[model samples]
Each structure stands twice: as C-alpha cells, then as structure tokens.
Target: ATATATFTPTATATATATAMATATATPTPTISPTTLTVAPASGTYGGTVNLSATLTSSGSPVSG
Candidate 1:
C-alpha cells in the first residue's frame, strides 16, 4: 500500500538519523574551542587588584 510504503521510508530515515546522531554524540563531545576572560585587563602593580577569570566553551561556563 502507498501509505505503508511512505511510512516505511520515513521510519527508516528517522531511525538512521537517530542512530547516526547517537553514535556521534556519546563518543565525541565538542567542548573544545574555549574562551578565557579576565577582569580589569590592566591594573596598578603595587595596589591590590582583585583579578578574576572565567572560562567558557560555546558560551557555556566550564566547570572548575
């Protein structure tokens, strides 16, 4: 039946896509390419400078 045939291909494509995505996702997480930011790029050397740094990957904070 045409209905059954259409359903079969759609199911196949979905399964294939899901399988490929799962296979790629679990083994390899793309968390590289990070950004590092430090507050107050310049400060007086002798004075007390409260410096802090934040590291992020893909706009998400990287856990310390």
Candidate 2:
C-alpha cells in the first residue's frame, strides 16, 4: 500500500496613489465717484461752436 498528497497556492498584491494641491486668494477692486459736465458755456465773435458732454456715477447717467 502507498499514498501521496500535494497542494500549493500563493498570492500577493500592493498599490498606492495620492495627489493634492490648493492655494488661492484674489479679490480687490472698487472705486467709483466721478462727475464731469461741459457744454456751450459761451462762444461768440465770428465762430461756430458745438460741444456737449455729461457723465456721472452717483447721479446715475454714464453711457459709452
């Protein structure tokens, strides 16, 4: 009489991954207070004058 037995099994695994980046700060812009007016204040003596300009911010009238 004779008897024999054999069994084999092996397994190994490893993994790693990482990434990170953060840094932000940007905010600064505010300055509004302007007013300008220019029109036909006066013009005489053989001349032709035509001028007009008016711009405001707090008064509510600023267009381009």
Candidate 3:
C-alpha cells in the first residue's frame, strides 16, 4: 500500500495608512492710533486755519 501527503503554503499581507495634517496660522498685525493737531488752537470761520494729521501703521508712516 502507498500513502500521499499534501503540503500547504502561507501568505503574508501588508497594509499602508496615511493621516491628514494641519498647519498653524500666523497672527494678525496691529494698527496704531491716529494723531491730529491743529494750529492756532481756535480760529474763526472767516479766518484761515491749518490742520495736520499724523497717520501711522505698525509704528511706521504709511505711504500713499
């Protein structure tokens, strides 16, 4: 009498996964207050007067 044996093979499995990423945002710049000055403290409507205003942004003057 003759006997036969069966052989079996095993397989290996691999998987890849990815996740979403986020970025940090930058802070906003701050604005400085405006300064206004007038010459001759008081003036009449008929009289001429001079008015001046200083505008600054981030501690620097803004260009037109």
Candidate 4:
C-alpha cells in the first residue's frame, strides 16, 4: 500500500501611526501715565523753549 501528504503557506501584515501639533500667540500689555520734559522749565515773555516726550509700553520701546 502507498500514502500522500500536502503543504500550505501563510502571510503577515504591518501598520504605522503619526501625531500632530498646534501653536498659539501671546499679547502685549499697554503703558500708562506717560511723561514729558522741557529744556526750560519756565520762559519769559517772547522767549523760545524746547519740549519732548518719552513713550513706553510694558517697559519696552514702541515702534514709530
């Protein structure tokens, strides 16, 4: 008498994943109680005087 045999094959699978990110912006604070100065504190009649001002915001200089 005689006998027979058979064979089989198999397969595998793979997968991958990714992550995302986000960003946000911050705001600046405002300045208060500004100051001004003059070259001559007081002037006589028909006299010329010079004046100027100092501006600041949150302790930082502001763009013109």
For candidate 4, the per-residue lDDT at 52 reads 56
For model 4, residues 1-64, the per-residue Cα lDDT tens digits are 6877776767777878888989887988774654343344566778975565556555655557
Candidate 1 structure quality by residue, lDDT tens digits, 1-64? 3554334444333333333333444576565799999876566888766768999988989997
Instruction: Please give the distance, in angstroms, between residue 21's alpha carbon in candidate 4 and its true position after superposition.
Output: 9.0
lDDT of 4 at 54: 53
lDDT of 3 by residue, 23-52 (tens): 999999885775443344567989987676
Sort the candidates on lDDT, descending order: 2, 1, 3, 4
Count backbone clashes in candidate 3.
0
Give all candidates' CA lDDT scores. Answer: 0.72, 0.83, 0.71, 0.62
- Root-mean-square deviation of every model: 18.1, 9.0, 4.8, 4.8
In the predicted model 2, the residue pairs found to clash are: none
- Clashes (N, CA, C under 3 Å) per candidate: 0, 0, 0, 0
TM-score for each of the candidates:
0.43, 0.32, 0.37, 0.38
Give me the candidate number with maximum lDDT.
2
lDDT of 3 at 48: 81
Question: What global local distance difference test value does model 1 have?
Answer: 0.72
Report the candidate with higher TM-score, 3 versus 4: 4
List the candidate 2 regions with Cα displacement exceeding 4 Å: 1-9, 23-37, 42-53, 56-64
